[model samples]
Target: MSYLPDRVPLHGPKFAADPHAAYAELRRMGPVGRVELSPGAPAYLVTDYRAALDLLHDTDTWSKDTRPWQQNQPADSPLVPMLGWRPNALFNDGKAHERYRSVITDSYALIEPHQLRRQVSKVANQLIGEFAAAGEADLIGQYARRLPLLLFHAQFGADDQEGPRLEADMAGMLDSQPDKAIQANINFANYITELIRSKRLQRGQDLTSWFMDHPAALTPDELADQIVLTMLAGNEPTANLIGNALSRMLSNPAYYSSLSSGALTAHDAINDVLRNEPPMANYSAHVPRHAVHFHGTWIRPHELVLVSYHAANTEPGPTADEKTAGGDDGAHLAWAAGPHSCPVKKPATLIATVAIEQLTRRLHDLELGVPRNELRWRPGGFHRALAQLPARFTPIAPDPDGVSPWTSSSPYSSTRQDKTWSPKPPACATSGPLYG
Candidate 1:
């Protein structure tokens, strides 16, 4: 494949600071263009909507497994950790992919949507109650990141304390720091391994037990892989989804008021965020089955090809503005498409919506603590997430019964010190909370 001159780099502060501008620059070259993923790992980015759909749907020409490409690279290659082969559905194709995907979708279906919403609301309020007395909090660190983990932990039959540990380690793994990610991967695996062993001896009604007793009857290693996949898949993207939507709500008063005043809905705000700033921004990584020329770019067999969900959604054209509103079928690629598209999008959306509504209603005066421009986002080739979202609100009494309902019975529970009851920070002028 002929290397494109001045390939766009998808790392560092410049790209992380303003990725939309970078996408605009890449769109000028063409739909698909050569780009450097890291120092030496180069891949083709699909920045056009139509081309992205083509690539995702044409799985015969593109495979999800990365071993074909990794086979020739040195053992210490950087790409190995991020895109290395796994036995789970995310890294398989054809019959194997179908088998793994069935287990996930089926297990997830066991939980009702309303149940999921209730659980999310319960978790959301409990989290809010923790910092309600403090008057100040980093929403991303304290609330957004923890909510999904807590909910997932309950489902996994793990205790609440594991949530924070999983949240921190997963954050490190997702960010582009290789050393931290390597250690995190190992630590995360060990944690899941123990969870699996515990479940094997004493199963419960949780998703973990459901998977173990399922018809497929996954082995221990397979169960751990599936659990780790679900945790990693569910954690970062959901955290980012909640964080990004909150950022949009707090930053744009007009938009925030519209949603709160019944002029718009949380669903609308979520769709807008999904279109403009997708959680998994540059993901759905695949490798071509063989050397193929696509959109004037000669991509070799087994070369990394990433579909730019953010870029494709924002690609300038006649229909670029379609994503600003909801009810548009075939509008955004945020949930992706094809056989490998996210199956849990509905639940994910519900969690984000319920979270936003619960936080706004409970606090009633939440507003950004720092200037919008001062917010920092971690740099990476895949996810688009906020590093933190500090905010201020009226201080209220902390919930006396703030402990998670699932904490008491789970074998994985931990007795971490309670800090949510800390004293409130000094008061400041606060914007009146908006309600619909």
Candidate 2:
């Protein structure tokens, strides 16, 4: 009898092209699997939610600064020279990363809850209103893409002219073309270095100025480095969350009606969307400590380990269902695990919640103007999102005095599935109160 071929399934570009299905298959393969990494670094894949969570935050065991798959370029040398390069906090580990987080926390999380909520609500409504009026628009390129950039611009006090250029540069950085990311990274770094210097000369009352004041604690160069990382790390996730969440609303016709019927809160919908498809499919670190006992394999040090955030979010358990219980599954490792999990978790969540709620309450029907299958999604970025999401919808008309309650009755059918954002308020300029 001829020997049978191994039935093992292979996942890589073939599966990464559309990772959800592959994730399901990987989930079935126990909590862990092995895969070859760039430069042939031996690596283990963590698909199990439980194990992945422990593996991520066990800082003692796993580290963010694991040895590079190939070799570590001198810290003085440029790590990303293509678009631009800035070390920021992600490039290091231990106390250094901690200090970086503290600075961001004060601005993002230290604000009083009342003020944060008010500001988020205001920004959400103002942005949604402009897009709602347009009747149809691309959610990713128009609203989802613009909102975070504006917020960051205001937060950092970067020039209004910078948003469009920065977004374009970010897109280029994600290109699959050889050396594109590197080129984009380098260019971006150089630009940020100069921007930081200018901000220092005439300090303004914004996040950038805050950094200028804290150079003793974080140095001007380090802050310049952080400027790039913070922008990249935050914007991409927001875009995906918006696009991915909108995808859910379109898929589940009942979702809009449920929300319009006052059965679900905006927060509830966001939780579901994140669980369904977070912006990032996965997060990787070089296993800085080197050789780790992965699945009983001695695997020598310097091996790469890939943690599947997408799988971890979908982990089947009550823990992941905290959305129902009114708590974010602290168990979901999408932000990574432990105290070191995504530093801006609180603010990112707030912004996402506010944007979704504002839009959900103001619109009636949301129909995709373009074929869903034809939509393009960008890959190879730190996060994943649509290159564009073409859509159309009708906004609820505002009341006589203008401000309508978030739960106002829409003349349009409760079941709309459109993705849009514009600079004008929606036909309906109603008050979009917070829900769930």
- Whole-model lDDT per candidate: 0.77, 0.59
Q: What does candidate 2's lDDT look like per residue over 1-436, in tens digits?
A: 5432222222234444576655555555567756433222234667776667667666776666544533543333322231122345665667887677666654443244444455555555556555666688777777787777667765676776776666666766766574776677677776677667778677665667665555236776677766766787788787678777776665555665554455666566667766656676665553636566655445455555667777667766655445233223454555665555667766777777767666665664666677667666664423556777777776544333334322245453223222222112112112222222
At residue 25, give the lDDT of candidate 1: 69
| C-alpha lDDT of candidate 1 relative to the true structure | 0.77
Off by over 4 Å in 2: 1-17, 24-30, 36-42, 68-87, 110-133, 178-183, 258-262, 286-290, 316-328, 370-376, 381-384, 395-436
lDDT of 1 by residue, 1-436 (tens): 6444677888777889999877876876798877777777777899988888888889889999988777877777766766888988899999888767767776666666766767777778678767877889999999998899888987787766677777677767765677888888787887787778788788765777767766666777777778878877888899999999988888887655544454556677798889889999998889898899888788888688899998988777737555433322368889888888886787788889999887776666678999989999987778899999999976766434556422333332223324322111212112221110
44 Cα displacement, candidate 2 (Å): 2.8
Q: Which pairs clash in model 1?
A: none
lDDT of 1 at 275: 86
Best by lDDT: 1
